[model samples]
Target: MTLRRLMTACVIAAGIAGSASMVASPARAQSAMEAEIIGFHQLCEKGDRKACIRFGILIGRNEQRNADWRRAHADWFWFER
Candidate 1:
């Protein structure tokens, strides 16, 4: 194969190898969910629907089920958006 083709193949292989080694642990997932909730709350304070829905989903089964679901439905306008 040509040098250019070999380099392209190497780059692709490297990218796949790098991504394969990348794993999101449960701890990382929890942390990300926490951050997302915080950011979503902030956005809700400023009135953002999509973020609110995400926030609700992240927290609905937590200590604020009713409230979160309410906001989620309201945010996305479960009846009408």
Candidate 2:
């Protein structure tokens, strides 16, 4: 993707991640989803190699109740192993 597209996707991912966790009450499942998404986005943007794997693991383990954070990012291979 172009830099503009990557940046735009980054911004959207941030919004999705933030919106999930900003809920006032932990009683809400959506809050957990939001928080996880936000965290995954954070780790991905920060280039946490483990977070990419972990994010997928989260979705696989938690299901929709926690949001599908795996789809939020594509692997950027050039800088990675």
Candidate 3:
């Protein structure tokens, strides 16, 4: 009986840990992307022409991925160009 209880507790702990990681995965990805963009932008600001183009391209691609966001920020996109 004691061994069975230990096995069940281990399973439950594993499941909780797995679900928690799944939930945080997307948030981590978004932050990483944001950080990458920020790095490109900083480099661009420091007069790196290639970084400027890369930053613009990344922003454009990201904006195009979400129609509603693209529409809402249409002018900002044009201004960036």
Give the top-scoring candidate (lDDT).
Answer: 3
Candidate 2 lDDT, 8-69, residue by residue in tens = 99999999889888774476355776687568757977999888877656666766533433
lDDT of each: 0.71, 0.66, 0.74
lDDT: worst 10-residue window of model 2: 72-81
By descending lDDT, how would the candidates be arranged?
3, 1, 2
lDDT by residue for model 1 over 1-81, one digit each (tens)?
A: 699999999999999888877753333443666567778988986889988887767776576755654675576435644
What are the TM-scores, per candidate, against the unseen true structure? 0.36, 0.36, 0.43
Residue 12: error of model 1 in Å? Answer: 48
Question: Model 3: clashing residue pairs?
Answer: none
lDDT computed for candidate 1: 0.71
* Higher-lDDT candidate of 1 and 2: 1
**Runs off by more than 4 Å, candidate 1:** 1-30, 61-81
Over 27-59, each residue of candidate 3 has an lDDT whose tens digit, in order, gives: 434467667877887898799999999877777
Cand. 3 TM to true fold:
0.43
The true-versus-predicted C-alpha distance at residue 41 of model 3, in Å, is 0.5
What C-alpha lDDT, on a 0 to 100 scale, does residue 46 get in candidate 2? 95
